[model samples]
Target: MIARARLIGVVGFLIAGATGLISSTQTWLLVSLSDGAAEPLAVAGASAVVLLAPLSLTALALGAALSIVGRILRPVFGVIGAVLGIALAILTAPIAIQAPVSAVSAEVAAVTGIRGESAIAELVAGITATTWPAITLVAAVLMAAAGIWVLATARLWPEGGRRYQSERAERRRSGGPLDAIDSWDDLSRGGDPTT
Candidate 1:
């Protein structure tokens, strides 16, 4: 049951990470100009001000990898990842609720290349909507849930054989050429190795 849970968590983390990464490139806000045309602005997930998308994605990836290895430190990493995810969600929610005026204004000015007191600038200041940020928030929540699951089930997870095995022991066991042979064979007809 623990193994199953861990597997589910790993899959969730991976999916969340991928979703966050993809959404980061999408437009977060739409700025409407004076001409009644909507201009897609910067992505919330990739915004420098938020800085949550990449961080959350990276944490989810690390958590998934650690969970797969079944190491003793998996729980620690998982908790850290979870906390990061939660932080991402918390930070992004407000941004999605209302677009930052200063940032949007600067972006609009840069994009439309219209100076102050211009009709376009006024339109840009008044036009802002939350779209992509909501998606990022959802991804962050998923990642956080996955990390928490991993943390809870990591101790019950099965240890990987390679993780505990020593390199010297493996080398010593395969010291001879016959170690590579699966079974001995005779050149006699109608001979059965098992018999």
Candidate 2:
């Protein structure tokens, strides 16, 4: 059913967004000192946001929006979200490969309390030896796949239920004894329940 597809799509986007959020906080760069003490350059999701905000934030917002909007608009947003995910993946590839030498060096210098050109060079070398960029790439791929799934199946989603309807509409229909009570209350307040 379309409703089921819509639910699945919503869940997919949510999972993708959650993954991206988690990936941002993960350690993207690691620095090992000469003494064999390994330290993280940036350990929070906030640091990753500096480099991946464009992609991560967009996916989060789109996923949240998809849950509220009607079925007809789901696919359109899905495609847009998918494109953003791909862009994120593309942008992340190089950072993952090269390890952002300068940034990592600066972070290492700050963390290790090292203050010499040679020391910085050694730290940079140590930092670059590790691989963390793959995290972002994986997150990006998940987001893209979720978006694609939504785009592919949105057309089959069912219409929203009465809960999505306006409050006024709920008062208009004559149901059981409760319906008369509701209409009477609306009329007493000088409000047209039918409207």
Candidate 3:
């Protein structure tokens, strides 16, 4: 069961990661294609916002979905969520790191006609444009946090499952006569709830 969950999670993460990169790349390319029709600064600002928006949203949506899904499964859900979250994070990091670097570099080149000038400051400005960096950071943080929640939820997986398995086994091992006697046995038996 855990193996199945792990497989499903890996497959889902791969699908999401691959599609996300391709789609995001396409959109950013579209933004770049807006070259001659508009002012460079507006184009830069607008495109930066556009590129960062969905990455942040995707991260957020993944986190929420993972948490909800984790709660439903109550165990393997965490492992699944964590695996998917980390895989997607690794897949998406290049683009997240790229946006500010690329856009700011482009604008800086367009404005100052220079290669690299105060790259750090430009990263800050571009990242802050429309507060997209904050949004992105929040989303990434949430994804990791949700993964942790899921991982923690699985701590009882072994013990609880083992207890249930033992009771079921004891019942299964009892004969047909015992099966017939089971209701009477329960009625006659008295024991501590703590056990």
Candidate 4:
């Protein structure tokens, strides 16, 4: 159960991050111009929330880091992941709730050369949200849950792998003949395997 918790947390974080990245590439909103002179402009999740890509990338990195970090750092990364999840939710919630015209204002301006919030609002007849925003929201929730899982189970996790073991432990394993790779590893740890 202990190891399962660790694996579950890591997998959850990774899946959530990947989901977020995928959603960012997808269209979050379709904006129909009031003039009806042009097709609705599609606004990608990244455009809806400028930080979406960066935050998703951060979550991916945090997930990778959590897999190998020592017990002491596990909770730290957990907290960071939770905070990131919350921030992501905050950024997307407004768009999900309101589907505000400003969400696609920049795209509108790019297409029609019109600027200013009020002007763009006038140009936008309606904003229709795609499923991507909801997917992102689910990802955010998963990320936070994974973070909390890590924090709760961090203490129960086993110590890190061989590389994280103590120098004394490595030095003691010198009974067998050392291969080239093993000799190099020992040398790097400031120990001569020849003894």
Q: Which candidate is the best by lDDT?
A: 4
Local error of candidate 3 at residue 187 (angstroms): 35
lDDT, candidate 2, 1-195, per-residue tens: 655776676676666666766666667766555655655445333453355754666777888888778867888888987887788787677667765555455555667787766667775545542244676677788778878988998777666565644444654454423366676887999997575
Relative to the true structure, candidate 1 reaches a TM of 0.67
Report the lDDT tens digits of candidate 3 across residue range 1-195: 552443343334334433443443332311222223343243332244344335434544553454334334645545554554565455445445555455455544665455654643433343323333333333444445455654654443333356665665686576323343455555567632222
Ranking by lDDT: 4, 2, 1, 3
User: How would you encode candidate 1's per-residue C-alpha lDDT over 40-102 as one tens digit per residue?
Assistant: 555344652346556756865675577556466778767876887798787777767776554
lDDT of model 2 at position 68 = 79
lDDT (CA) per prediction: 0.65, 0.67, 0.43, 0.86
TM-score of each: 0.67, 0.64, 0.33, 0.83
lDDT of 1: 0.65
Quote the lDDT for 27 in model 1.
66
Cα lDDT for residue 140, candidate 4: 91
**lDDT value for model 2:** 0.67
Which of 1 and 2 is the better model by TM-score? 1
RMSD of 4: 3.4
